[model samples]
Structure formats: structure tokens, C-alpha cells
Target: MTRGSLRRIPLRIFSGLLFAALLDSQALAAAPPEVPPPYIAAPAWVLMDHDSGQVLAEHNADKSLPPASLTKLMTAYVLFGKLKSGNLKLDDRIDISQQAWNAKGARLFLRPGSSVRAEDLLKGLIVLSANDAAIALAERVAGSEINFVAEMNAVAHRIGLDHTVFMNATGHDEKGHAATARDLARLAAALIREFPEYYRWFSLKEFSDGRITQYNHNALLWRDLTVDGVKTGQSHSAGFCLIASAHRDGMRLIAVVLGAQDENARVEDGQRLLEHGFRRFETRLLYAADIPAVRPRIWMGDQSTIPLGVGRNLYLTLPRGWHEKLHARVTVRESLNAPVQRGQAVGTIALDLDREPLAEFPLVALKQVGEGNLFQRTIDKIQLWLQ
Candidate 1:
């Protein structure tokens, strides 16, 4: 081969290598983003966003299993609803019944005939996971534990807990008395959202009734600064379970770990799930509620255009640093006729990421628009026909 041809051969080889490198770079850039599910040592688990009800991650989240003390969450919810509706008062006294006194598992150590303040029992029920306190409160509201279990089931159904069934108010293990991690997550979010005033008790590290002092079983509260009130349950059938919530940077997340091997496993696994969630994903306000998102042209209306917007603020949970990738498309009818009522659904607003819809909401009229005068309608018809 000629010397010059040999030199050209080296240059050609270098160019080929450079082209291959560029192709590899392009392939990496085009790859889809990944947020792998965390490794949690539990039979069933779920992590969710508080504001949006978005399930960030899960494994066996829908499987029904023993919930142990997490049943107390329902008990607390029932009492809170009563407090809100004036059926029960915080200071109202409840006479402990024989059944409540003989209740099993963790308890407030109430005597059969002794009277305890309803508020104090709430403190015991929540802070100590007191079986006695749960029963006493149940009897106070429903006259018996069986009736109170019925009330719990009714509320559970209303809140969309399809997999949850309550045999007793204290969360004792029994056939058919089970709840899934997803349902428990929903219950936790509802408890926080529905009773903000009463949720403060969950954050209390310790509660005292002038004799015995009980600390919250949720260790996350002391370990993580953002961790707040929640419930933990442990039983031979259920293993160890914890439902915890944490708030950071205006975002709140609920974590549930069920059937862990032990208390430490539950706490560690719960914390790992929460940290994985907060670290790997973030919550973003996609669009403000009640703010005009778009104004579409109106036909045969007193106004030339009608304001369109979402009814409530739209929030989305996405992989961290992915907010900029979100895009929204407004869909509306070809023409709108007036007498449009405010809040009338006229169209839909869809949110997309990577060209796929992640969520959608109804687009509604922001203001009422009356029909135009007959002459105006006629003119509009002529204009449309001319076009």
C-alpha cells in the first residue's frame, strides 16, 4: 500500500470510532427515565403523596393482611367525626365496661367501673395504642363494641376501603379482619385531611394521665425531623406494621410497611421507603385551581370568549427534576353556545409527560355567559357561514 493510503486508513478508523461514540451518547440521551421501586422488607407496602393521593411506589399494596394496631386509626377517625358533628365531646366522661376492662393486648389499664374522660382515652388510644381506651370510646359512641365495629365498617366503606374489615376496634387478629396497605394509606390521608385539629395528637411524643406515661410507638417521629403522627401495629399473625407520614418542602408523604419481621424492621423499612420516596420523587403544582388557564372563543354569546380553568389546584408527583418535562393540552368543543353556567364542564385539560398523559381534569367555565341578542346571534351565524 502507498504511504498516503496508509495515513488515510488511520483517519478513517478514527472517524468510525468517533461516530460509534456519538451513537452511544445519543442512545443514552433517548433512554426513558427510571425510578426503581425501593427494596422494603415486608409482605405488603406502599408510599403515597398526601395532597394528590398519588401512589409513588408499592409492592403487594392491595393484598389484604392483618393490620394489628393500625385499626386504631379507624377508631380515632370515628371519634374525630363525632367530635366534628357534635355527637361526642372531648370532656364527656365514659364509664369503663367489664368487656373493655378485660380487653387484651396493649392497653391504658382502665378499671371495670372507673370513669375516664373521653379526651384522656383518646390520648391513650392514640399515644399508647390502648385496647381498653378503644373499646371504652367505642361503647360510649355505639353502646357496644359490636355496634362500634359496624360503625367502623360503615365509615370504611364510605372512605373507599374495599379491602378492610373490622372485627374489633383494637385491631386484634381474626379471620376476615384485614386491611391492605393501600387502604391504610388512604385512611391515614383521610384522617389527616378530615381532622386537622385532632391530628396533632399523633405528633405528641408522650402522653401522661398523672400516673403512667406512654410514648408513641412510631419511632420515626424521633428519628426523622419531618416524621409526624401515625400508628404502628404488631402481632403474631401480622408481624410488625407501621403507617407513617412525613412532611418536607411543602410536600407530605405517607409510608406503610406491613408484615415486617420485627419492630426495628418495620421502622427501618418504613424510613427507607419514605427516604426513597422523598429523594427519588417530588411533588409539583401543575396548575393553580380557579385560575383561568385558557380562554376559548364562544359563539352566540354576549361575551366573545369564555374563561376556562380547573376547579381545584392540580398537583402531580413525578421523578425528581422532571417538572420541566410536563406539558398540558386543552381540549374543547369546536364552538360553545351561551347561557354557559359558571363551573359547567366545557372541556378537559390533560397533563402529559414524555408524550403520555399522567393525569387529566375537567375544564370548566370560570364565569357565566348569557346568550346574545337575536340580532347578535344572526350576525354570528352569518359570520360563521361566511368563514
Candidate 2:
């Protein structure tokens, strides 16, 4: 080629590369701006990333304390599960027993011998923290409050709430009824995540029963546009407890405050936690389910490769400034014996930030691999011996 033509070719290649680099830089710059950390003051509180389940800030998060009306969160959780399972319906009418109406705390103005639909009662229990409504729903679901409490504890365990115990449906500060801030946040998250339809009850600012109109005790619901429905609790011993969730700019956060000195403090602390969560962090989807992270070698198996996957969806909650430092490592067993079942956990994928372990999820087998036949096994054994 002529010298001039050769020089022109080089110039064109350089220009193409420069244009691609500029486009990449512009795309990165177009990403959303990071939030700032919020200011807060409360003795015991927790801020968590709603999508990733990462603890952003914790102060006495696991210290066991009376959940007070926060106990109603568990009550609502059980009721929601029942509704989802078809055991209860919105329009189903429930008879108000004397025990439910006269249980002695947080009445929904329910009158004994009166009938109300399951859906309205739930609103009373969640929005109003009505003890009567909670008891009524519990009785309807499990035949008795005692049995229903058992189911509540069972669900708590299933949700990995290790520090929770349910003594009654109303969160009346009774003996043995308590949960920590972290535990309550987990319960709140479960409700929002597992039962989005039923969780809407928390968002209702007002509900009436033809005689009286009750307002939600959670003050943040009205004060902050980002705040949404979550339960609040108060008692002489439990002080004021709240599980508040809010969504801002596509990010959701759950904040829990237990044993605050007054109603104002509870709301203030909750807002602080939420603001901090939204400001300091961002939720990023890491890897999805059934997406292979690594290939596991099978010993004496017919298949040459076993695809490794996570058991559930994976996400990471990281500081906005540390997005570039996030990293992941997949650890799998060197070799597996035949007879692996699909969905069986075989390993773990650990997510780290600056070499610190942030989250770990079980890595599972994506497909089943049957055990080799006797002849195949014998051949494999010979091959192994040779190796």
C-alpha cells in the first residue's frame, strides 16, 4: 500500500477506538448518583438493605427486648400466609368472640357477637394495632390463640428469625413475647416479600368500622412521602418499637427500632435508619438462579460436567463508593460421587468487598446426575486406579 493510505488506515482505527472509549465513559457517568448516610439517634436500632438482606448499621440489634405492638408483625405475617394458602378469604365473615373483643388491649372497637370480614379485621390489626382484631384472626386460623402462637413461632423459625418468641397475638408485653430489632426487620421483610398483597394493609393510614375511625400509629407514614406501612408497638416495658419500611428512587429499606423512650423517638430513629440505608447504599443484582458459577467434576459419572448454581436469587448491598471493589468467589467440592440430585446444595459462593466476606449463598446442582451402573462403576474404578 502507498504510505499515505497506510497512514490513513491507522488514523481511522485510532478514531474508532477513541469513540468507543468515550461512549463507555459516558454510560458509566449516566448511572444514578449515590446516596449519603443519614443521621440518627436511638439506643437500639438496625438499618438493612431490603433487597440484599445486608445489615448496614446495627446498635444492639440482637439484644432481646419486648416487641410490644411489634408483636403484631408476626401476627400479621401468620394471617397473610393463611390468606395466601386459601385457608382464609377477604370476604369471609368471622364471629367476634368475647375473648377476642374483651382481650383488654388495643381494641379495634369490635363488639362481641358482631361479624366482620377477614380483610377488614386485618386492616384493624395492622393499621390500628387492634388486639381484638388480631385475636379474632388468630382464633379463626388455628382454632385457639395458643395453637396460633405455635404456628407463629413455626413461621418465625421458617423465616430464620432465631431471636423471636410469640406469647400472644396482640403484642401486649406479656411474658415471653419478645423480638429484637433485627428479628422484627426480618419479619417485616418477609411480610413485604412473601405477601405483597397482604402487606398493603400496613399502608392504610385510616380505617373505620362504621362507629370509629382509627389512625395508624406510625407517624412516619404521614410525615414522609417515602415511608410505607409497617407496624409499631409500645408498652411500659417495651417502650416504643417500630418496623418501618420506605422506598426512594427505586431503593427499598427496612428499619427497626426497639425500646425507644417515646413515640417520637421511635419514629425519629426509624427515619434515621431508613435515610442512612438509602443514602449510603445501593442494591445490585449479582447472579441469578440456575446461572452456573462453576463446573464441578464428577467422579466415575457419565456426564463430563456438572453445572453449579445458587439455590435462590443473589444480590449485594454495598456502599455506593465501593462499587468498584466488589468481588465474588465460588468454592465447590473438588469431586462428587455419583447420585447428585438437582437443587441439592454442593458448595457456596462468597461475595466480598475489599477482601471482606459480605454474603454467602449456597451453590447447588442445576441438574440431576444418576449414579453409574455396576459395569460403569467398575470401569471408573479401574480408571481411578490408573490415575
Candidate 3:
């Protein structure tokens, strides 16, 4: 084949447990169409499969609405960055300002004109959804809530939260403070994936600040053992909102509920969304980064061949019975030359399920290749001329 032309090749068949699972899935493949996803009661909601980053179900996911205290998810993400970069420390004492002390809605009740540890303040922000704690942490990290909110908006843009706008760190009722359910779901997933170390604090049921104790506003943690950390919010204008995450049997799902009727409605909406995702879909790992499933020939190079595969963990989320219909194939560009770098795109790995397009990922070189020897190069040049 000429340069830039594609040569198609099949991947080796699976064996062992994966084979058995696929064989089992064959029976389920011909079943009736999947049932409709659960109906969410909130004004906006999203259910995301964490492993695959796929939206299983959503309603009004892109409509801008008040996030209420759920805005702290972004605030916590910012603070976690400061902690990781050594710009701030958990033990650092933050001097309380009048603004923080007077922050209404939810209060941590920090002593007037006293200093508090950054770690404790985080606990209050996440578990208690305390407005005062959000202000204090903002001041500690960015010198003031105003500056911290700027940092928050910058981070939001950097992380692909294009539909969100943060007016305050505490998620108070501001005229312009808004985030879509889809954006909030992405934000929650980012917090879980980027800061596993700090995410554990969100699961705390209760936190004590010497004089007072407050319980986490996310009620799903108490109702379901599988449910873990996430923030909750309620305001006169925003209604009730919850971003709930739950893990079961190695699979995790994130559910975002916004503008629910009441606190109980938010929890119920979020839980049902999570349940719908785990029950209807399953996430599978297809390939690990740097591990090649295909090795096509390489011409006029130091190496005779190059392995082609994904550059990151490749995952697919599908209905429980569709695994048997998922197929992967590679199409490599022909007549590849020398000096290919590791991780450079070489071809395309096309994925299809039930004979329909699912996703496509770049098949990359698993190893580098340099020029071939002079003698080998001369012979290859002659062979190329003849062809």
C-alpha cells in the first residue's frame, strides 16, 4: 500500500474470564430495547458513569440554574490545588474577617476575630456547607473572596466547565451565580479524579469547631451505605440541590439534582439517577495506556514493527447486555517511515457496538523508532522504486 493508505487488521480474540463474560453477554444481546431511564423530579439533573465519563441520563443538563451550596465543589477544587502546590498548608491559621463572620445562610460559627486552621475550614465548607467557612478559606487562599472567586472562574474555564459562572464561593443566592447539571457533574467527576487525597473529607458525617458541630447536608450518605462524599445545597431561590456519588462493586456513578422541590426530593432524585445508571449500564476497560493490541509493519526503520494502541485508559460504558456486540479494529497508515516518537498518533482505533459507531481513539506508537542502517535503507529504497 502507498504512504497514507490504511491497512486494516483484527485484534486477537479475548480469552479466560473476559471471554466467558462476552459469551454470557451474547445471550443478553438479543433482548428487547433497554428500558427508559428513570424520570428525575428536579428541574435539572444528570447521571454520569464515572469510569467512562458518559452521560447515562439527563434532563435540562445544560440550562443555567442556581447551584446554591454546590458551588463549594469548585471552591474545594481550588483549595485542593493550593494545598497540592505548597502555596497553602492545612495547619496554616487564617484570621477571620468581618465579612466571613457575617456570612449568612449557613455559618460555621467561628469565634469572632479568631484564627482557624485551613483543614477545619474545609470540613465546614464540604460537610456543613457553611458560608462562613467558604469565606474564610477564600480569604486564606486568595487574600479575599473576590480574588478567590476569580481563581475559581479561571479554574472552571481551564477544566471545561464552559456553562458555569461563579458569583460567590459560598454558593449564596446571587443573581448571576449559575451552573448547569451537566457542568456540575463534570466538576464533581473532576474533584473525584483530580484530588483523591482531599476528597475523603467530603464523606465526613459531622465536624466540630470547638463550640459547635454540624452534620453533612448530603442525606444520601446516611440512607445508602454505598453513597460517599459530595456537597448539598438549598436556598430560597435555588431550591434544593445535591451532587451525590456512590460506589458499588468497583463501579461509581455521579448524580446531580438541581432545583428540587425540597431537601428530600433532591436526595430521592439523585439516588434514583444513580440507581438507574448502575442498573442499566456497565463500564468496561478496553485497553490500558502504552499497551498495544496491534503491531503493524514499519518500513525503513530501525525497528521492523510498531505497536499501535491507545495513549490512555480506554473505557466504554454500555447497556449491560451489549458487551458482546462491542468490536474494536485498527486501521494503520501504510509505508511508515523512521523517527516515530512514543505516543505519536499512527492510526485510528474504531469502536462500534451493535454495528453502530460508538467512539474512536487515536492508535499511538507504543515505542520510539529511529532510522534504519544505511544498507537496510538502500535496499528498502530499491524495493520501494520497484513497487
Model 3 spans with C-alpha error above 4 angstroms: 1-35, 375-387
Candidate 1 off by > 4 Å: 1-32, 299-304, 372-387
- Each candidate's lDDT (Cα)? 0.83, 0.75, 0.81
Better of 1 and 2 by lDDT: 1
lDDT of 3 at 41: 79
Q: After superposition, how far is residue 142 of candidate 2 from its true place, in Å?
A: 2.4
lDDT of 3 by residue, 156-233 (tens): 999889899998998989999999998998888888988888998888999898788778888888899999879898
Residue 142's lDDT in candidate 1: 93
Ranking by TM-score: 3, 1, 2
Where does candidate 2 clash, by residue pair?
35-279, 69-233
Residue 218 of model 1, lDDT score? 90
Cα deviation at 327, candidate 2, in Å, is: 2.5
TM match of model 2 to true structure: 0.77
Residue 178, model 2: Cα distance from true site in angstroms: 2.2
Candidate 1 C-alpha lDDT tens digits along 109-164: 89999999999999999999999999999999999999999999999999889999
Q: lDDT tens digits, residues 1-387, model 2?
A: 211111111000011010000111111212233444455565678887666676778888998888888888888888887888899999999999999978777788788998999988988888888989999999998999999999999988987899988888788867878788888877787788878777777888999987899899989989898888788888988888888999886567899888888889888888878777777787655555556666656665667467877644555555787756656666666556678899988776665565555455667898888887778778878766896
TM-score of structure candidate 3: 0.89
TM-scores of the candidates are: 0.86, 0.77, 0.89
Clashes of each: 0, 2, 0
